[model samples]
Target: MKILLSTLAFISLAVLLGLLTGGRLSWLVRNTTALRLAWLAPLALIFQWVFFELPGMDRHDLVFAGHLLTYALILPFIWANRRMPGMPVLAAGLGLNLLVILLNGGMPVDPGLLRAIGRVGVYQDLASRGWSGNAVALTDRTLLPFLGDWLVLPEPFPARGPYSVGDLLIYAGGFWLLAGLTRRPAETEAPLKPA
Candidate 1:
């Protein structure tokens, strides 16, 4: 839920930046449609939804495989679009997430970060029970704890949650990419020079 909210918030900001910069929504639409391997994104989301959102899926033994598969599916589309503005940042973020997930078996969650974000109950539950959904509580055994979901947006912020440094980078890249699209075509694309 927080991930979805964070994504929406970043996209909203990007759209606002686009309009403020006199960028056409039509351009965003057209450019996005032209992206290569775009279908992979929706397919990945659907894959995640099937594994995590469908009723009784939480109990399925393959939930872990589904979680890891989500990353595998997303990385390729990001790679295919690597030359796009801000895609490198997005790729770095996704890469960091994939690293931590691969190392730790899932995204690690810091109970302290959760508490700081007004999720004490959730923190306590995780602290006691040790695992929930695709996230595992950050503990001494957690490798590369620094890469875990230690970031937080506290109260009064419309969008708030336990996110990782990687997640922030992903959102920032999305914002940059969308906002960059609003620039005049000439500014976005350099004139070809004779070699």
Candidate 2:
């Protein structure tokens, strides 16, 4: 959720910057028309279905399966569109995240990091109930610990959160993808128009 929000925020900043620099906002939409981004729909739809009725889900394993499927699905989409701008960076982020999740059985969010955001109790409650999306109770056995949500954003933001390096790559890729739309190639003088 935070990843999506932060990506959107960056893309919004790109739009604002584009407009300020005499670029038409419409240009971004027009250029993005060529991208086959519908490949990402399942990722969104599965999550929407999960989070909408988050209280009813009793098994983390099922949630984990959905993620596995979604991330696995991204590979073919990326391969087909590898030539597109920003796709490679986006693929790198997705690959890192998928590798971590597969190795850890889920996202291995540290409890202390959750505590910093005042979200530890909520995760604790979920654990008591028999399920949790993350908050893996960080331990010696936890795999790929560095790839988890290890970076902290302390007090004074709209939300207190820990983000992963993969999130940063995704944000950068999304920003460049949109920002590239506003750029127009330099015009050359038309053979010095004879007077």
Candidate 3:
């Protein structure tokens, strides 16, 4: 339910911004490639949610798939749009995550944090099913060098929310990229006549 609301809010915000920015929505829609990729995000998001919520499913597998979709597919798509400013930053952030993943074997989840967050049942289930410890654990110590590990972030206010440094970097990169892409390029000024 929260996911759905968040998704709707994102869409609404995008549309509102598009309208305010002289109808970029139509321009984006006219670009078939961009349009297709834009649509794909929501679909991928739905699949991700389903994979995580389905009963008797291996969460590690789903988590891996989610990361693969982002790193392998979505990142490439963003790269293909390299003419857009800020793509480089997004690519760099993705590369960092990819490096961590490669170094740490699959996803890097901290087991202790998972236990703290009431995810022990899910972790136990995945572990029993032969998932790698890095894939299902929930500890900062365990996940730091891994790709998925970068997704977990501890809350700033000491509340009970876990997030990763990678997540922060990703968000910052993504926002920067989006802002760059959405900005209108400056128009060239004609030479001034002699006064």
Candidate 4:
């Protein structure tokens, strides 16, 4: 899917940048605190699996699987950096997403956008085939507030996909916190050795 391709591109870019910088990349998750606290990411994902689900199997299930796998890989880094400064922010973001998901009946999709993406046929097929036999139908209008509406930005430049404001904020905050956590703390000077 396009989302998966975009994610792979992002990860490739991050790794390429890390290599080019001779391992000086601040967001590389090389420090102890970051590695340790990463556990929370996976744990949060597990919560998603336990809590979010429709009646039967659906394509949306891939979202939870992606989160679980991503955090699983990052867990070692978080565990190593358990004392890092950014865990709180990470936790907060996770909480926000969880809250929105819980409030939105397990999935955070925008039906309008889903329709725009031409998935109405798929949804109709699913319903007709009883794939979502027990699941309730949802519409964008039914979702609350502007924030609850999954409004994706139009592509700002050629070759780039759309992104939401929240996505930008989350990405910025994540990188900033990761950078701060990975950099080695400045060493204090020993009161010049007595001559």
Best candidate per TM-score, number?
1
The global Cα lDDT (0 to 1) of model 1 is 0.76
Instruction: Give one digit per residue, the lDDT tens place, for model 4 in 1-195.
Output: 565576566555545644464444543443423243445565654554543333343554554454445445554544444344554455445445444544544334444454564557535643453223112234444343332325454554222322334345455545545445334443111111111
Per lDDT, what order, best first? Answer: 1, 2, 3, 4
Q: Compared with the true structure, what per-residue lDDT tens digits does model 1 show for residues 1-195?
A: 766776787788997888787888776766666666888888998998888667665442366689888888988888777767788898889888878978887789987777777777667867876655667789899999888888767576655767798988888887887786665545443321211
State the C-alpha lDDT per candidate: 0.76, 0.61, 0.49, 0.43
Give each model a TM-score: 0.83, 0.76, 0.56, 0.49
Error of 2 at 42 (Å): 6.9
**lDDT (0-100) at residue 148 of candidate 1?**
87
Candidate 1 stretches with Cα past 4 Å from truth are 1-6, 59-61, 115-125, 183-195
**Pairwise lDDT winner, candidates 2 and 4:** 2
lDDT minimum window of 10 residues, candidate 4: 186-195
Query: In candidate 2, what residue range of length 10 has the lowest lDDT sum?
Result: 186-195
The per-prediction tally of clashing pairs is 0, 0, 13, 18
In model 3, the runs with Cα more than 4 Å from the true position are: 4-56, 59-70, 126-134, 138-161, 185-195
lDDT of 3: 0.49
Question: For candidate 2, lDDT tens digit of each residue in 48-80?
Answer: 457434776556677777666666666666665
